[model samples]
Target: MDPFEKMSLVGLRRYQAIVKAQLPIAFSHALEETTPWAEKALERLQKRENLVTEAIIKLEFGDDPDLGSQVSRSAAEE
Candidate 1:
């Protein structure tokens, strides 16, 4: 078996059952704050650069075939 195929960075293996009992979809890789301020910053970056977009997230996880293959959308997407 591969070491990282199903690897989860932040799961508590010992307490997974307890945690799952409370929240069904606990995240593995956490995203930074997506507050209004962050959204505005993202917008500003997008305006300043051609490649800044939500699809970049998929590009960032490019090592994982499942996520990497999700592919990026055209920059013109709404």
Candidate 2:
């Protein structure tokens, strides 16, 4: 089985939080001109962050019957 499939809900949330916390650092690095590859790395990290966040939301609420409305409400709040 895949690592993500094996991860608990709490573990997935924690991992997502960790990735979010790293966004500031990644953004800062991306702003620097010294490292030519920093922007590419940051883009990859952002993509990973989106995937993890999506996974968390799916695992937490995908089974809910009102998932569409719930997601819309949550997205609005954000």
lDDT of 2 by residue, 2-66 (tens): 34776788998888788889889888988975486888878888887766766666677775758
The lDDT of each candidate is 0.38, 0.75
lDDT of 1 at 20: 35
Off by over 4 Å in 1: 1-30, 51-78
Candidate 1 accuracy as lDDT: 0.38
33 Cα displacement, candidate 2 (Å): 2.7
Worst 10 residues of 1 by lDDT: 22-31
The local distance difference test score of model 2 is 0.75
